[model samples]
Target: MDERFTIRAMKKEDIEEVYEIEKMSFTAPWSKESLYYELEQNLFAKYLVVEYEGSVIGYCGLWVIMDDAQITNIAVHPDFRGRKIGEALLRFSMQLCKEMSAKRLSLEVRVSNHIAQSLYRKLGFETGGIRKNYYTDNYEDAKVMWVNLG
Candidate 1:
């Protein structure tokens, strides 16, 4: 939890490290192709990586469309969890969303992920709705959350 840890826009070279963290952090993680598509094709997508001491420990992606920003994904390495890295990443993403003139930010979290729910709530996000059987790997429901920025 060093205060010197930095977050910056993700580079193509950082995808491997990001991918590793994605795999480690989620049970049904995004495929490499899906991530590459976001990096190479999504024009409105902004991806970021968190680095501490030159090592990538976490990543987040946002897709901005009009006045809304959709959080595509966020993950932190297991070893780096509980150190506030996720909170830092979320705050950074919120700032980026505001800079983009987004009126709101939205994301979906597994309903069972209480830890993430609490973190998002602390950041001013509220549960908006639920998507039934949203997670493909295990058919878990997703709790859609949103934060009003305006």
Candidate 2:
């Protein structure tokens, strides 16, 4: 398979596909209604989707406020995981934040998600702290990670 992945700003119509990937990738997925709200109502949010052959295969959610930015969520379809799509999405998101003049970018990962944590560290993120019981589904502590964009 020729994996020609393209990343672009997500549109309202991409919600259903994005929601599917979201549900498959996370233990507690965001509701489609919440995605609608993110696209239609959230002022601090920006979303980007990765398209492969006209299908939405992955997505990233970003929230920028002042000079700080947060990765609200990010995921790639299981069928597309080994291609480093998630890393690409994170790189793109970091560039977007830099373009927006954000001095720092941060996100939380489940402590058990070492693959993701490895990717974050490769992108220069460092562990900042731990959030207790961050994942409601399993009550797993979240490892807070951050990187300096400046």
Candidate 3:
């Protein structure tokens, strides 16, 4: 397979492209203002962008607090789906957390996102709990997943 994608630290300039994928991937996408806030003001936030031929195709965000890390969000462009781009991005995030001395990582996924859940499981994440009505858009439940990196 062609792993032509390049992953790098996200920048303020990447927001427009990231927002495009965000809207395409989520029912209720994060606002540009919110993304900007995270990139500029959120001290705990760290984001990575996946680029293909110089275009931002995927991205993931993580927050390392003390010995724990939390995945904020991850998404890929629809055109780039099924190419393992999301998986690559996630694996990269896991490494970043480890480098930051995080002992574990966790994230919440929509209960209906079986594909994502499967990927999480393949990466050694275990279902820890469920957050009821986690999605404000449709009141969908979210499954919380965790992995011990320690």
Write down the TM-score of every candidate.
Answer: 0.97, 0.97, 0.97
Global lDDT scores for all candidate models: 0.93, 0.94, 0.94
lDDT of 2 at 65: 97
In TM-score terms, which candidate is top? 3
Error of 1 at 16 (Å): 0.7
Pairs that clash in candidate 2: none
Where does model 1 exceed 4 Å of error?
A: none
Q: After superposition, how far is residue 92 of candidate 1 from its true place, in Å?
A: 0.8
Cα error, residue 98 of model 1, in Å, equals 0.4
Predicted structure 3: lDDT: 0.94
The true-versus-predicted C-alpha distance at residue 42 of model 3, in Å, is 0.5
Runs in model 2 deviating more than 4 A are 1-3
Query: For candidate 3, what is the TM-score?
Result: 0.97
Taking the tens digit of each residue's C-alpha lDDT, what string does model 3 give over 106-144?
A: 999999999999999999999999999999999999999
As for TM-score, the candidate ahead, 2 or 3, is 3
Error of 1 at 80 (Å): 0.8
